[model samples]
Target: MADYLDFVGDPGRDDVEGWLYPTDAHLMSVVNDLQVDRGFRGDVLEIGAYKGKSAILLGFFPEAGESLTVCDIFDSGAPVSDGNARENTAFYPGLLQTDFEKNYLRFHDRLPRVHVGPSEELGEIVAPGSCRLVHIDGGHTYEVARADMETARRALGPAGIVVVDDWSSAHIPGVAMALWERYLTGELIPLAFTKGKFYATWDPAGLTAGEVADAVATRPGIEASGTVRLGRYAAAGVTMTPGDWQRYNAGLRAVYSKLYADGGASAPQRVGF
Candidate 1:
């Protein structure tokens, strides 16, 4: 986190900004920092790309040879027949409106390869053991998230980094819990856990999620409310067990409930396995 780089506007800045999609600042910071620090030489992938906000951020990295892949259904509300589609569109209506093709072309040469389909269908598109960084922002439901994580894991290389969003949101927690109960419990040590983000580095050595919980518990100012920056570009190590993840989730739920009771937003629906 020491060497921080300020984001500079690219040619497509204005056009990409007009879209309705919102990119996570923390994630943006993480990507930029990684590129600045790591100099992105490996492939980049994002599970849920809405109008390519993150894709654009990924493009900003000064990585010359890296290939960027974007996966999305691109149905818009037009095929909003299912309850899930309806709900998805309710939150994001411009899925179809935003000219993804044209908007993507804003990057012109840097435009990433867009995989048009569901996560499962698009999973195999990315070759196994080829990616250096994978961002999971696709379906919030558990099953979808789990599948997406599996796909990302397949594509991820030994030193690859996996970033999962909506850690605090209920809908996304299914994926969160599954990863915790499984890998976090067994090994796959957590590198960092932000307020609403879970970052785990793939390590052969089995590290428990409790180890991560312990790390968080000892952070300088985490006891205070709101998301605290646990680690900058530097990786923060954590370990946790199955029991630890459960207890952590319970504590998070309680905290979230209190926040909502005070008129704050409730956590998003957790992904269902």
Candidate 2:
């Protein structure tokens, strides 16, 4: 209750522009807390921050000594290869770095170290094995996702965590292909799977993987993330708690209801979509 859930679970944060499934953030908070409880200290890294919804959630932790770094192309004309121009154009239209900074400053006084260019440049931007956790949510294409994963591999410290968003999403098979390659090669070990993210780590003995499942399984907002056989590895299947499901819908309804009651510009198509 003293962590990210209190902040991100607040309905007020919905005003921030971005997509972050509440459970993904919840799982992250629980696992990160466990790591911190076990006396691990390192920086945090995030790739492809849209407008700082997830970034602010990450900002909740990181004491004076610890740091957080965010990377995004953010209207910077970062090149897209393998026919991803269409994807970029459709997904991020008129996204500005200032917009993200504004949203972040709403929650925190100062911003994390921001990298406003190709995520591949993270190799030079962050020192090797300095990050306790890395979230890979940048490009969706195979090449870019692969490059981001490589950067994550290098950036993670001992018992570090890697979270790849949009893994196994149908629209972006390239993201799936990139992460799956790591799973197959036995480099990144699977810890948990969620609707919008894939959680893993380089813990070769499944120690961190089992700990992640055990940590979040009994947490308030997450379902029982029991261990399940995922290929050659044992991991957990993550989902929203029943309370979270109802709260999510109720939150949407409340937002739209207030919007229309105030005569907002957009018409209400569906109350909860």
Candidate 3:
């Protein structure tokens, strides 16, 4: 665990709430990539905003006019009738099992929308192509993740980035497996899975038939909510605002660069949420 944490960068950061909160490292990477690589400057859509940690990170990017939309099934929103649902409830009990209300209040006026409901439900509320980045941190089940991914895909802009949390993590092996199998065929590919979170991108021009066939061959009948093409302006690097760069040490960069090094379009298997 220590090695994993070290390899992924520190799990402890004052800016980030805690383990319960999504790490800023992933969002930081996304912001830097979008600004420098894709020239994207738009709203960020976060599917799950437990304690608003990850949303905070996205909120801090240099781009002006870029807002954030938060979606979550807070405080018993998900009915716990079956075994899996009960397990989910147990895992994230009673409003994120944290100070979600306080966190919600913390970002009350900061972001654009504080959507509360299931991913599918909230998906309808978001306008198509309104999101430049979709962060999926909702449910871990295959059905739920797939639905969330589809919604994010539809909501994202042409050169948008879709980030899926816990994609390559042991905490939810089923989600990771489903993501990998689907990725093999889709235009979306795994970018980075730092700190138990996985990032994927959509290139409107990148989708291919061969990849889809391969994905289908590996996992048959697994349908995606939607698919998009991979676009140009491909950019991946580590560039932070001067202040942020100084605050975060070189050790963090070394670790992140290594983690994101061989993490191109290939499916990852060693990630544990």
Candidate 4:
């Protein structure tokens, strides 16, 4: 199967629009690819499909029998809170459902199941224990984010992965608060965390934290910086900002060039993600 990077091209050269970082993109692909390789088949869900940058990547990894679903309140005035409404206005000004659909169709022949409303509706729309991966990136308020986290728990199967965006952003302390509350008392087991997202699981029966960290280590440009202690437990920590990504790309180019020069046409140009 073709990887998302194959469709999008070199991250440093062919750039796509939206907020998805290159490091995050690589990690997302690795998570899904690992599940697919292990013969695990299930639905995929994204709580926030902001212009389909990440959604397009999610769409690429679902196998034939699997499905993908995305939910967002695009231009609908459907946000449940004033803070969430303000977030939409400030961060997603003039956004429309068509904006996401247009960008999505550029890469995928069809769009995933789209639910245009608050992320709260996802628990009712998406069946419980059905999804393998649930990306919770909707509202940033503590109320909305906590609701989304609960929705993710209900929507995931055993060992299913849950990724929460802006889990610890300084400005979005609510998300961090909600995240820690769940991590401390809830069943969401921590797997890993990057700069912008936190990865966890509903159950370790299907996938362990160690396994996730191992998979992340295999992804390009991501450096494992030991673990983050959560009480008695610990979660893997990874680091790679935009500057690090640029340096990683430069290093890759240098290696590829050296390989070609040393082995002529026999050296591989590039491998799929």
Using TM-score as the measure, the top candidate is 2
Q: Write the per-residue lDDT of candidate 4 for residues 83-170, one digit (tens) a residue.
A: 9878877877888899899988878898899999988777777988888898888889999888988888888885688888888679
State the number of backbone clashes in model 3. 13
TM-score of 2: 0.89
Give TM-scores for every candidate, taking all chains together and pairing residue i with residue i.
0.61, 0.89, 0.62, 0.83
Q: Write the per-residue lDDT of candidate 2 for residues 1-273, one digit (tens) a residue.
A: 354456555554456656676787788888778878887778999998998888988887685688999999888887767466787788778889999999989878999999888887889979998988899999898888988898999999888889999897799898999998988987778888887888898866434666777787668778754678868888788887777778877877676677788676563322221
Task: Please list all clashing residue pairs in model 4, or write none if there are none.
Answer: none
In model 3, the Cα lDDT at residue 173 comes to: 73
lDDT of model 2 at position 180: 89
Which parts of model 2 are misplaced by more than 4 Å? 1-4, 10-13, 205-207, 256-273
Report the lDDT tens digits of candidate 3 across residue range 1-273. Answer: 122222234322233343422133434443444444546656778887766655555554435666777777666455522644765556644556246545544544444467776778865678888777787887777777777878887897766667677765676776776676667675665443344555566765432233332332332112222333334222222123344334344544444566578875432212112
- TM-score, candidate 4, is 0.83
lDDT of each: 0.55, 0.80, 0.54, 0.77
Where does the lowest 10-residue lDDT sum fall in candidate 2?
264-273
**Once model 1 is optimally superposed onto the true structure by TM-score, how far is the C-alpha of residue 272 displaced, in angstroms?**
27
> Runs in model 3 with CA error above 4 Å?
1-17, 20-33, 36-38, 62-64, 76-84, 96-98, 104-112, 204-273
lDDT of 1 by residue, 1-273 (tens): 111111211111233432111123333344345434544346878887776655666555435676778877776322322544755766656566256666666655546787777778765578887777788877776677777778877887755667787766664466676565546444454556544566776644322233333444543223212233332323343333345335445654665566589677745332111
Q: Write down the worst ten-residue block by lDDT for model 3.
A: 216-225
